[model samples]
Structures are given as C-alpha cells and as structure tokens.
Target: MTETLPETAERLTVNTAPNWRYMLQEYDELYRYLPAGGSDKIAGHQRRVREAIARLLKRNADVRLQPRAVKPVTAHLRRALDEGRTASLAPAVRALDAVAEDLSWQYGYEKVPKGLSQNYAYAELAGTRGPVVAEDIILGVVLFAPGCTYPAHAHKGITESYVILSGAVSENHAGVYVPGSMIYNPPEHLHRITVGKSEPALLAYAWMGERENLHEQKMVFTRTRK
Candidate 1:
C-alpha cells in the first residue's frame, strides 16, 4: 500500500542533483517509444505522460537525491539488470537500472498475501512524495522478483500506464509483454501481473486522475492467484 503523503507544493528537495537529473532524463528516453497506431487509447496515454514530464522539467529544479538504504526488492532489480546485460533491453531501461539503487522505494498493497510483500516494490520520481512537481500525477519505476505474482487490484478514479522496461510479464494471464511494451488501465480496471519464471521484471509507471488524488490515491487490492 502507498503511504499517505501530505500534499505540499513547496519546492521539493532531493539528496543530490545528479540522481534527480538522471531520473528526469528517463522521461525523454521513454517517450521515444510512444506507439503510433493500433489502440488510440494507449497512444494518447503515452502522449499525456510525455507532455506531463515536459511540464515538470520546465519547473525549477528543487531536488536533493541520495542513495536510499537498499530494500530487499532491490536485490531482484540488481539480478534482473545483470541478466539484461545479455538480453535485449531498451537503452532507457539500462540507464535507469544503473541508478536504481539511488531512488527511495516502498511496497504497495499492505494487505498482500504472505511473502508477496518482499517480492515487489516501487520508487516514486514525483507525486505527493518528495520531488513532487505535478499534482494528480505519479511517475516511477516498479519491480517484481522472478516468479513473483503481483496480485489482482483495482484503482478508484485513476488512469494508470506502464512501460515495461525489462524482463517479461503476463497481464491478465494472456499476452506476454516484453521491453518497451506499454499497458494502460483506466479507472477500476482489474488486473494482475505474473513475472516470467526465470527473470525479474522492471516497469516504469505513470498514474493520473481523481481522489485528492494524491494522498488519497486509492489502489485497492483484490484476490490473488492461488
């Protein structure tokens, strides 16, 4: 479960300048893959994220970035990055991985099934949390350990998008998604993710919509596959 971060428009601070810069650089690196055809919904969602980041960059850089204490989930990120050395991954994924250790990360779905908690985590670049530039929008990276299954969940008043950075994940038990694949879920879209058995998965995500929509962004957990 995401924490209830109090909203404050104060110029945010980071632990260091370079780490913040690298994270912002990922916005451009990721925008290059916005799909041109097929589903207009996805194409439009990608465009919105790109534009939002563009606006974020125009704001004054009030950041302080530092290496956060490594969490257990980070181990899987490290392992997946090591595996990606030989696998085909987007250059943006590689760049983000190089600085993965510097971002602060947290677990989602507090009531998740036993053991699943340690298998997944996310790092926020902007939100109610620090480095917050835009309101009602969230940009971050999420990771799951190999063989981990992020349980079924639904969001209230939120539109979320994810760009798969590395490894593979099965969404809704169907399509096998790989690097650069984009997934968009409208409010209340019920979905779960299962990582490939041998490699972990890393995904860059953006969420926007209602609730106070920041501190109150509600991501409700449902059942898990048994």
Candidate 2:
C-alpha cells in the first residue's frame, strides 16, 4: 500500500538529523502539489511534517560547529558516487549521508573565495527508485558561508530549485531568501547565489538531470587583487 503522508513524514523525521526539519517542511510542501483528491488524508501528513520541523528547530541550538572559508578559485564538488554508473540511488543516499555527517562535524557553511563556493549533495531517488527520464531528481543540501559568492551558472537539461533550510541566501535573480523560502531556476537560466552575514546558510535543492550536464554556465566578472 502507498504510505500515508503522515507516516512518511514521521519516518523521515525519525531518520534524519535535527537540522533537517526545515528541509522536511519543503518536502511537505511538495506533497501539497499532489492531486487534491487525497487532501484530507494527507492533513495528518502535513501535521507530522510540521511537528518534525518543530522538533528539528528546537534542537538547532545544539549545533556547535563553526563556518569555514571557501576560496573563490576552488571548486568544491563532493563527487557523486553514481557518476557514469547505472547503479541504484542507494549509493547517492549514502553519499549525501556522508556529506551531511562531514558538514555537521565541520559546521554547515564553507566559504569559497569571491568566485566560488562549496557544495555537498545527496541523490535520494537514485537509491530508492532507480533512474527516471534522462535523469532522476537528486536531493541534497548546500551550505554557504558569509561573504561567499557562487558565480553565475546554468544547467542545460536540468532545472533546479532550492528551499532555504537555515540562515539567509541572496540570489542574483530572486533577491534575498530567508529560512523557509523557495527558489526555482528554470533550465538554462543563468544565476548566482551569495551568502550573507549572521550565520551559515543551508538550502535543500534538487538537480533534475544527469548531474554532469546540470551546470551549463558560470558567472563572469572582472577580478582584482586585494
């Protein structure tokens, strides 16, 4: 039987770290976009998702790591384990779990010089449901440190979307997005994201195609030595 939304939310909450509440809420919202016939049945699902988020928020204060510097010229791609392989998404999930663990220990944010930043990704569908279409949506989290700028970039076949899980993010096309906000980048739309002060920012995103071809463009800017 198809699992009920509440049950699914509960399972997700129980399995993830405390910081994942905001991310869970994003998934809950995605559920809302499902067909309307099951709305009532899913009400409990929404509640479970909210409760999970609340639990996570309450535990946020317990996080103790500090943000690290991200250099402009360095590219921080935590290579995907499923790259060039037709394996199941399980490896991708493990990769994300590993990244999350590392991020938690090292703090959520990483500063990438003026022109670049760090990224940690996990592909959920690959492990659980196998590949679909030309690609499958990979779910992962990205942390950004203050003063870091992610140069403009675009994905050719893949459209991407992010849900702000913590802190704040300033996007060139979408403006500033605070926690709980969502942003969408249609296929091939050039854009950039810059982190702000106060704390490291975390966002949950989905890469919609072959991970390799996802990034089609990067921002252009003149550089000067400090």
Candidate 3:
C-alpha cells in the first residue's frame, strides 16, 4: 500500500501534485496556433506527440516534474508556428510561453554531436522527469553551430516542424529550405539539417506523437564514405 503522509501544522501537504491545470492552459494556447486538419496527412506525427505526453502523465500522475523537464515543451510548441499549421498552433505557443514565464524556470542544454568541432544543442522533452499534460506534442530545441551537419534522420510515429529563430540553417526536406525558412516533415520522411555561415542557428521543434514508445528507423547516409 502507498504510504500517506500527514499535513504540516500550516495545513500544507508534502506530496502536492503539480499544477496540471496550468499545463492544460498552455496546451490550449498551443492548439490555437496549430494548422487545421493537422491530422489529415500528418496523423501519425500528431499521434507520436500525444503518446509521449501520455507516457509522461502516467509516470508523474501525482507531483509535477522538475522545471527543466517541462521547459522544453514550450519551445517545441513554439516551433509548430510555420505555414499551414501556424493558425492552429499559435494560441498554444503563447500559452506555453506564459507558463514558462510564470514558472521562471528553464531547462539546460546538451550537445548533439555531428562531427569534430560540430555540434547542436538538444533539449529532451520525454525523459524520466518532464512536463506532463496532453499526449500530443513532443517538444525540444536545436541549436546548430556554424557549418555543422545534423545528418539525416527519420521520424517514427510523428511529423516534425522546425522554426528558424537565428542565423541560417538548411533543411533537406523535399528539396532544401534556406535560412529564415520553415520545414515540415511528414511521418517517416528522411532528411538532414546543416548550419550555414559564421553565426549559430537556433530553432524550435515540435514532434506530434509518442516518441518514447515508437521506434524510429535510422536512415543510412549513403553519400558519406566510411
């Protein structure tokens, strides 16, 4: 049986759950900015994002996850603000930003290595501890160093969207997306991203579906010689 703790003299409990209502508020905002009929050709991607969120809620059914874990979701939702889906995802992005601002907490960054002296900052949204709300959005940020190649990869059960904020990054999806551009990845679409020029490249990314449960098949880089 689960042990129950007594309340403090001040009437406060030790195991208070995180503010899920607030989380939902942000989610509502994000939904407003997303594209309509996002699930039409991109149903799988949306499923993955939702699945990841479901897993998080299941794990942290009581208390809130640490601030660092939840912070990435805001960025992920923000990235969904590209053409076609911008109208539906706008409110959600605003809500997420508000939550981040209210919490006054942010997650740390890590490096995704591409090659020697080339790397990108990655923020994980679906780990042991993260924000738990709806099961529809996997959020994160990618920061690319100048001239860095992110290599080709494929989304498993979700579609991905990237919004460029700073510098220049090239995305090879369908063809190529230049700086100040946005790229959308349909489920299982193979692609790569590389930074351009001397400045750093920053982007917000949102993947729709259950990333943790789904297995992403890695695409071989045939152009690269071993």
**Per-candidate TM-score against the hidden true structure:** 0.82, 0.44, 0.49
Q: Which ten residues in a row have the lowest lDDT in candidate 3?
A: 10-19
- Tens digits of per-residue lDDT, candidate 1, 1-226, equal 9899889765443324555656666765675565745877777776777776666666644554434855577878776666655555456666676666567877655565787777888888777654544565788888888889887887787788887778899988979988767777888899999999888888888887753755686556786557
Clashes of 1: 11
> What is the C-alpha lDDT profile of model 3 across 1-226, one tens digit per residue?
9999996643211123334434443333333344435455544443444455545555543323444432322332333323213333344344334444323233232332335123444543323233433234545445565666777767666667775545566667344443334567877777777766555555656666554532342323434447
lDDT of each: 0.72, 0.43, 0.47
The model with the greatest TM-score is 1
Candidate rank order under TM-score:
1, 3, 2
> What stretches of model 2 exceed 4 Å from their correct place?
1-99, 102-135, 210-226
Judging by lDDT against the true structure, name the best candidate. Answer: 1
Residue 214 Cα positional deviation in candidate 1, in Å, after optimal superposition: 3.3
What is candidate 3's TM-score against the reference?
0.49
Per-residue CA lDDT of candidate 2, range 67-118, in tens? Answer: 3333321132222222201222233233344434323222212443433333
